[model samples]
Target: MMALNSVARADSFTITGVNGTGVTASISNYSLVGNQFTFTITNTSVAPGSTGTITNLGFALPGNRANNFTLVSSTNSNYTIAHDLNATSGSQNFVSSFDLVLIDKPNGNPTFGGGSVKNGIAGGTSATFTIAGDFSGLTADQVAHAIFARFQAVNGDGSDVAGNGTSPVPEPMSMLLFGTGLAGVAARARRRRQGAKE
Candidate 1:
């Protein structure tokens, strides 16, 4: 079997959700270069000062691949890398389907058997997580159909986000294109609002 960091490639996939308007997430694989892998969740449903939190997120592993379980870090404490997220203390979903999970806490949860729901990922922000380890044989397909849970301020106070899609690797160009598209959409809406105001 090929070990991780053997090749430098990025793969990306879409994560769909409900009870919220236009909520989505993405996972970018970049482990082949010994750099890092990231998962970003964007919630665009809740208004300002409202609370729309992503409490749980799980990624599946195709062909029953093993988790390397190395290091987990993020720009903020909103999320912690929990290859094995815990669900006993607080609450979590998708323990059997998803092979990896980015949890709200990461003290002893280094394996994907459970989960947590503390200070979950916030809404209206692009919360990105950096996870490192031996993810040899991991591909973009594994993350295509992601599953997650959100709480508060959504369509009737949050719901589960789950679905599947293509297995295109998260290339930098692809991410840029996606980001640009989102920006374009936002700009158009902003202009429309401005026009309405005028």
Candidate 2:
């Protein structure tokens, strides 16, 4: 078998009953590269109501300081990043906040999934978006321990979702070590087979 240099691991979780707004959110995909974590969020309709618009999204650092977090990039152009101090104070302050607005559109409908706005995400309709950033000067274990995300939709509705237990893939060196052990076992087995044949 061909050797692998590295492997990527992903974890996901669903966010339901978001502040009782009948809108559900989920982390469809999550990955860590170095100190950066890239993730995708998918929002779906849960009950009957107007299509709730996402107002803000925030990520908390828990015990970490605000300086440890950095804003990398977002695929949505209408969203802006800022610091959210309402969640906590002092060094335990939340990392960053993303504010979203629907502009130049009638009915004030928010657009997701590459600028397609529908009346409501209800009836099995859904929208997906992505956010990525770096947690500066932190190890993989540290990053995994610090994955807490909060999101808010219009009318002061929101929800909190934690991205914990999402472990990083095994390092290339570990894979190599495992491969070496398997090779040795195979060689021994082959030698035993030849001795029996003789």
Candidate 3:
């Protein structure tokens, strides 16, 4: 349980279709700074050919871990945060599995859940959806925690992103090293002050 601060960490995971091409995807900006979280989604696949779905793509703000948060703001009125599918092109397929977990730091460990979406080839050329949610119950002390989303692609033959591994966590040694570095800097500063006095 780290102390909350003025900043919050955010991350993104892209679920590519079977063809490794783009799919129907959307993203919107949210009160990332105020609430200490933000996100974005980009469609890499062109239109009229490839397609896929991106689902279960969201993270929980560390502060609001107790009470689940939901995305209230969205670029599209019909857009929702839960399981979704995208198919605006051909046979291209984009989908995912697992849920999102936002922690306190780039290396800090946090909780996670299951989520996903399937992308297909239908609708228009491209579609975007941006959303924001209420994280009111979270304590102020947990604000600095980071945010991350677990992604996976299911079905359609061979290996898929659904089986993709989770984002790596920082090792204990790394934290120890960071602390040592900070201590060294403090010691040097103290020695310099003492030398100047003498």
Using lDDT as the measure, the top candidate is 1
Best by TM-score: 1
Q: What is the overall TM-score of model 1 with all chains considered together? A: 0.52
Q: TM-score for every candidate vs. truth?
A: 0.52, 0.45, 0.36
Colliding pairs, model 2 = none
**Backbone clashes, candidate 1:** 13
Query: 63-170, model 2: which lDDT tens digit per residue?
Result: 444443444655544444444334323332333422222221232333211222333222243333333444555433344344333333322343322233344455
Regions more than 4 Å wrong, model 1: 1-13, 18-22, 26-32, 47-51, 83-95, 106-118, 140-153, 169-198
lDDT of 1 by residue, 84-177 (tens): 4442222334344545666555425454332343455555555655666554555433333344544433444544553444454464555887
Give all candidates' CA lDDT scores. Answer: 0.50, 0.42, 0.35
List, residue by residue over 48-133, the lDDT tens digit for candidate 3.
44433333343323332333334544333333443212321233222232123221122122212222233321223233332334
Candidate 3, lDDT over the whole model = 0.35
